[model samples]
Target: MIYRMLAINIDGTLLQSNGKLHKSTKEAIDYVQQKGIYVTLVTSRSFPSAKKLAKALKIDTKLITHRGAYIANEIGRPTHSSRIKEHITYDLVRLLEGFPCQIRLVHEQFSLANKYKLNHKLLSKTVFTTGDPIVYSQQFVDSIGDTIADEPAHPLSIEVYFEYKEDLKDVQEAIGKMYHEVECIALNDLRLDIVPTGVSKLTGLLYLAERLGIKRNQIVCIGDEMDDIEMIQACGLGVAMGNAPFEVKRAADWITRSQNLHGVAYVVKEHFRKQPQIEFLQKLNIIK
Candidate 1:
């Protein structure tokens, strides 16, 4: 059937291997928009990061960011948020104090421990950037400090990045057992994310659906990572990219080709083309 909205993940799902959107993907999205189906981006990146992609797509739709801890519009206006409790935040900071791995705190953005150190460089590369580490790190820390100290309210979300895959799992398990109120998800082999319980891409999509007056059965979600698990399963048509892990593929209702091959475009076109036929048959109660 014709879906009312489409929720697509950013990193591996939309952008190509080089972190650029393929021409075919953009054209397919344009085609769907012209058909009056709302397209929204669901991602783990912060609003600032996700903004660039949204702008590139010419999307005026809502964004789910910080792994679904925060939801905002294209212009970065908060529509909903779920934050780690203050006590839990302090505990997390304490837990990371002596870890061997690099620690970066994310509050709408990322901040490394040292402004002018190798840690910052490592983090930027791991997170998809080649900018000056000193400048970026200082700016990030300053932003976080200001938010924590001056803002009347605490940040709505926080994320800590680890360098190694093994370290990430250890930290995830430790945090999971320590704090019963938080949710920890390992994004990939190299990254781990923690958010408040019940806050996820699915939660963000539901919030958006409520605002748009659309039902769950009228949505389609596509992704290729662990964070996308909940969203894909919840959507009426849950799709996993061909490059997605075995578990992710198993969780999906359908698996499209690899991202490098314009997988997203293929899936969108297939759904868009088939939706009309399904709707027409249903209208006549052909099989129902």
Candidate 2:
């Protein structure tokens, strides 16, 4: 079948383990855009970080960011947003402070974290850059609660990092019981992302698809994480990287080489080469 849109995840799918984009990946993306295909970055990262990578690749398509809570175009104007409520944010911060985890409030314009925990390696990866820090750089606050009190309208989601499995489970359970409208997703073994109910990469993608007039079967999604599962399942062609977890690979229609091997370039090259014929058949309703 013909594919019109390519939704790619960032962390594991695009960036290598060293957190750098492959040269071939950029070439492949440019190749697809040359073929008249729409390629978008669907990630759990904040807009600033995502935008930084997209600019590096010279990608101009709309971005699905904040774990599907927000979608914005090349200029960073949000086309849609699903934000967490103020009361719920207050409740979450209060409940999480009791645990030993570090909490970060993610917003469209800026992010806020505790002053003491901003130096964590992973968190720093998101907040600081090699030279100039992007827009999503985290601001260390003395108290997250007070930051929320000062500017409650800016939050899009909450990110929590735990050192122990027990604390993670406890926080997950507490969130489940207290806020039915909130959803907690374990981005990895140690990181948990909290967004509003019904928000996901697929949700944001669907909105963008409707606006662009693209169909489900005409889209290809490539990802390598639990949060990527939904879009991987929903898109017409789902691709998983070789380094993806067992479950993610199982959910995909195909698996490519690992990130370091330039898997994204491989997929785009192989698929778009035959796209003309596929597009012909699809338009004729000869292949569903």
Per-candidate TM equals 0.79, 0.88
Per-residue lDDT of model 2, residues 241-278, tens digit only: 99999999999999999999999999988788777654
Mind giving the per-residue lDDT tens digits that candidate 1 earns over 1-288?
Answer: 558788999888998888789999999888887766789888877676777778888888878877777788743458887776766665675576445444445555443332322253455565433122432332334233334444332344444556556777888888877788887766556555667888878888898898888788889899998778888888899999998999899999999988899999999878886554434545688522
Pick by TM-score: which candidate is best?
2
Per lDDT, the best of the predicted structures is 2
lDDT of 2 at 39: 88
- lDDT of each structure? 0.72, 0.82
